[model samples]
Target: MKEFASIDIGTSYTRVLMGRMGDDGVIQINGAGVSPSQGVRNGGVVNIEQTVQSIQTAAREAELMSGLVVEEAVVNITGKHLKGENSRGVVAVTNRDRVVTESDVLRVIEGAQNIRIPADQEILHVLSREFVVDDQSGIRDPIGMTGVRLESEVHIVTAGKTALTNLRKAVNAAGIRVTNLVMSSLASSEAVLTSGEKDLGVAVVDIGSGVTDIIVYVDGGVFSSATLPWGGSHVTQDLSFGLKIPMEAAELVKRNSGCVQIAAVDPIEKIELPAMSGRPPRWVLRQEIAAIMEPRMREIFELVDQELMRSGKKNALSGGVVITGGGSRVEGAASLAEEVFSMAVRKGNPLPLGGFFDRVDGPEFATSVGLLIGAAQSTDTARKAPRESGSGWMQKLRSWVSENL
Candidate 1:
C-alpha cells in the first residue's frame, strides 16, 4: 500500500492525516494528528517560526504513528487575499465547418486564461462553469460536435504571492514538499459535497477560529468565495469581554454553552462560570449567552448572504448551504443558517474515505481529508501524458516530466 499525507494549516489548529491507497481505489486513513496552530490569524501565516513548529509537530506525530516517511504533502490555504471572479473566452474552431475536436476545447480554455491578475498574485484555479457551443448554450462537452465557435465560462481563483511563499516556506521547513495548494473552502467542499449538490447549486461555509470562509457553487462551479475575519475567536472574545473572564475560560464556556438560535436555549437554563483572578464566580443564563452569539452569528450569515446576492447566486442555490469546520460544530448553527438564508441548511461532516477516519470524522477534518483526495487526483494527473505537450504519447510524457514532474 502506498501512503500519502495531507496537512491543513488552519487559523486555530493544524491537522495532518496519513492515508494509504488500497487496490480498490479507496483511500484509507492510517494515522491522524493535530496541534494548536500559532502564527496564523484570519487564514494568513503571521509568524513563520510558529507556523513551522505546528506543521512539524503534526507531521512528525502522524509519521510516528503511521511509520510512513512523509515527503510530499498537500497544503490547504485560505485568506481574505484569495479572490475569485467570473470570465468568458471564445475560440473559433480550426475547421469552422468540421466537428469540434479536443484541441478546440483546449483552445477555448486557453482563451479563458486571459485575466488581469496582480503581479503579486498567482492563479490557483480556473474552473469551467459551463460551455457554450456556437449559439447553443449549457453544453457540458463540445467534442465531436460541429460548431463554428466554442466558448467557455470559467471562474478564476487567485491568491497573494507573499502569503503563498510564506506557506510554502513553512512546509519546506518541516522537510516536506508541498505537492499542491488548495483553497480551504474548496478543500472542505471536496470532502463533504456530492456531485449532485454541486450540479444543483450549493454554498459551503467553512468557519475556523479567526475567520469564516464562504463559497457558493452554481452551474457546477464556484460562483463566489470570500472570508469574514470573525469566527469562534470572536465569540470567545465576546464572552471574555462580557463576563470579564480569561480568554481560555471564555473559550471553554463558549464551547460548552454557545447556541446560535435562541430557541435552542432554555430560559431557565443556568451555567456556573469558572472564577477568574480577584473575581467572584458568576452564574449566567443560557439566554444571555445566546444573546452574545446570536448577533455575531447573524452578522456572519448576513455577510454570506450579501456575497451570494452579489455573485447573482442567491436564488440559484437550490441545494442550500453546507456548513463545515470547527466553528460550524456549534449547536444550533444549522437552524441559524436556515433562518438567515431562508433555505435548507445542514452541518457537513468529512467524507467517508474508509478505515479509521470514521472514528475521527467531523467538520474540522474536512480540509485535511480533501487535501488527501486532491493529492491523489494530482498524482494521477502527473502520471499521465498531458495533451498540451505533443501529439505523440511518448513525446508528451517526456515533455510533462521535463516541465512538471
Candidate 2:
C-alpha cells in the first residue's frame, strides 16, 4: 500500500487528504481534514505565520486520522499572478529511419517551451495539446511515425516567482515538503471532469472564497486557463453591505438561504436577519438576498465567458461547463452559469471513491481529491518508467538544472 497526500490552501479554508492505493488499484481515502484559512487573501499568503498555523492544523488532523506521518504532499496554487499562453515549436527529425522517437518528442516539447518569460516569473506547466507529424495534425502520440518534421502545440502556465516562493515557504513551515505545486483549476478538473468532457471540449470553473480559477479543455487537453481576482467572498461582502450585517452573519445567511436567481426563490418566503449591535432582528424577503447575489455571480460567469471568447475557443465548447469549489455549492449557481455562458452548466463534485472518501465528496473537496489522484498517478508513472521525466514540477526542476548547473 502506497500512501499519498494532498493539500489545498484556499483563501477561506485549508484542506488535507491522505489516501492509499488498494490491491484493486483504486485510491481509498484514509483520512481528511479541513480548517479555516487565516493570513491568506485572494489565494496569496498575506501573513506567513497565520498561514503556517492553518496548514499545520489541517495536516496534523489528517495525519492523526490516517495514522501516517505526512512528510510531503502535492499542493494546490492559485492567484491573480498566474498566466497562461499557447506556443508552438517545430523540429526536424534526427533519426536514421526518419521515424519519430521518444527523444524527438521531448526535443519538440522543449523547443515549444523556448519562449520569452519575465525575469521574475517561472513556468509551471507545459501541457502538450497536439502533435503534428509532417502535414498530419492532431496526433497525440507521434512516436513510431515516420516524418521529416514534428511540430508541437502546448499550453504553458506560468506563475510569479515571488508567489511560488511564498506558497512553498508557507507549506514548508507547516513541516511538510512541497512535492509539486499544481494549478487549482487543473486539479479540480482531474477530480470532476470525465474523459468525454475533456475530449468534447469543456470549461471548468472553480469558484473559491477569494478567487475564481478557470481552465478550458479542448480535444482532451488544456486550451487556456485564467484566474479571476473576485470570488464567493465578494458575494458575501456585497450581502454584508447591502443587508447591514456582519461578515459572519452575511456568510451564514448566504449559505442558508442565498440564491443567485431571483426567480428560483419563493416570493412569499422570508429569512430572519440576525440581530446586530444596535439593530433588532428583521425578516427580509429571500428575493432581496437573491438580488444582492445575482449580480455578483453573474459578473463572475460573465468574466469567465469573456476570457473564453478571448481565447478564441468559446464556440468550441461542446460539453459546456462544470462548476466546482466551495462557491459552486451556492444554490442556483449552475443555472446562473448557464444563463451567463449561454451553454449547459452543472455543479461538479469529486468523483465517487468508496470508503472514507464519502467524508470529502463535496465540491469543496474537488481540488484536494484531485491533488491526491494526481500524486498517486505520478508515483505510478515514475515506478513504471524511471527514466521518463514527468511534467509540471519535474519539468521545472529539469529546466533549472540545465540552466543553473
Which predicted model would earn the best TM-score?
2
Residue 343 lDDT in model 2? 93
| Segments in model 1 whose C-alpha atoms lie over 4 Å from true places | 95-97, 277-280, 384-405
Off by over 4 Å in 2: 387-405
- Give each model's whole-structure lDDT: 0.82, 0.89
lDDT of 1: 0.82
lDDT of 2: 0.89
Against the hidden reference, what TM-scores do the models get? 0.92, 0.95
Alpha-carbon RMSD, each predicted model: 3.7, 2.6
Q: Model 1, range 1-405, lDDT digits (tens) per residue?
A: 457788999888999888877777888788788999999988899999999999988888887878887899888989888888888889988975668877776677667878899998887766667778889898766667887889988877888989889999999988899877888888899899998999899999988888887888887777788777878788788878987788899888888887878778899999999767777778999888888888888888888888778888789999999989898887788888899989999999987886677645989898889888877665555555564332233233222322331
TM accuracy, model 1: 0.92
The residue pairs in collision within model 2 are none
